[model samples]
Target: MKLYQPGDTSRAICPHCGKLVSTTFAYRDVPFEDGSGVVKGILAAVCDECQNVIAIPAQSTPAIRRARDAAEISLEVSIPAPEVEILDAAAYRVDPSATTRFRKSLFAFYLQRLRHSEETAEMLRRDFEAWNAVKTEQRKRVSRGIRIPHRRLSFKISPKTDRDVQWLMETSGMNKTDTVRSVVMEIEKDLLGPNTPRELRHLQDIAAVVNA
Candidate 1:
């Protein structure tokens, strides 16, 4: 691979302009691919016409990796036992070896999906509402319903996902733990279904990298 420095000129396809365009390498603050945080003053290929940071050069990768690692936030949630099983099951289904590591990746994947679209976020909201209703009814009939054991799950997440979780909580009107539970419920429905999940290959790809 070719390394680049500031002032090096190149040609590449520009997504903004939707065509092949001339680019110049320069030092600039570039946001993470998901637009969560910015890595300051990195050498990147900037589109000539659109003036956007089109791509990071090979040599600047280590700096971006360091920044990304530092930007990760901890996400923790106490969920019922079933949710834990569901998450692990989904992870195992994706890749038996990466079961534990993929839990974080699985949640992050859903976070990105739900963050970008309101329709997708509604899945979490609906699941949350259903859970609240069940818990309220169980409280009313305290002697009858069995209390499920709770387990705590914690992992480091990207800054973008942290923001997404906040947005999800705001829209779903649910606390962080319940919101996380709802996400697991959604995952159970999709990943554990009899029909092959549309994202099976995609998730497996993610699991491979996370394990690596």
Candidate 2:
């Protein structure tokens, strides 16, 4: 199967819009069953004009074969109940991305159904209210401009600790960075209660600077 390397662009007719468009090849995370797991290096053709994915037969054939093999292996293995629940939740989880197309598509689908049924309308109304609440909180944080900046931290750990981290990744469905952050939060809660004096002083300092 021929694949386009990085910095290569090919002209193709976009199936979605029926227009001749430039297709850019990029490596994207192809999720297995929504987002249960991701195959990190899948080659895909994305149309520049329509912002839609163009189907490539050669690339898809091998992916389909690998998916079948993985599915068979998954059926043969036994997963713990807690792990299974985590995997199930991960399947529907969405990451923060450049585009909200998936979310918009879901909203459109629900909105269409709502026109025919009162129950659907009620559900959609509640969903919007919940979403708005989250947005409102985020906006408040942004307006305050006192959010801590994230920094990269690196350290070496023993093999036992590495194994524990792997276990936490499986159980919590968090990447290593997030798992470490969660551990730190738990430790802080235990040691300093919900609000630490140091943190309060730091925030106060920032507030004073902003006020000035």
Clashes of each: 0, 0
Candidate 2: pairs in clash? none
Q: Cα deviation of 17 in candidate 1 (Å)?
A: 16
Candidate 1 lDDT tens digits, 1-212: 98787889999999999999999999999888788778898999999999998888789999999998888899988876667888999899888887577788898887676675666677668867886688567755874667768898999887767878999888777789877877777787789999899999999888888899
Candidate 2 segments exceeding 4 Å error: 1-3, 31-39, 57-60, 72-212
Q: State the number of backbone clashes in model 2.
A: 0
RMSD of each: 5.2, 22.6
User: Best by lDDT, which number?
Assistant: 1
Q: List the global CA lDDT of all models.
A: 0.83, 0.45
Superposed Cα deviation of residue 148, candidate 1 (Å)? 4.4
- Model 1 / residue 36 / CA error / Å: 3.9
lDDT of 2 by residue, 94-125 (tens): 22221222322222222232344445434434
- Lowest lDDT sum, 10 consecutive residues, model 2, at 73-82
lDDT of 1 at 119: 67
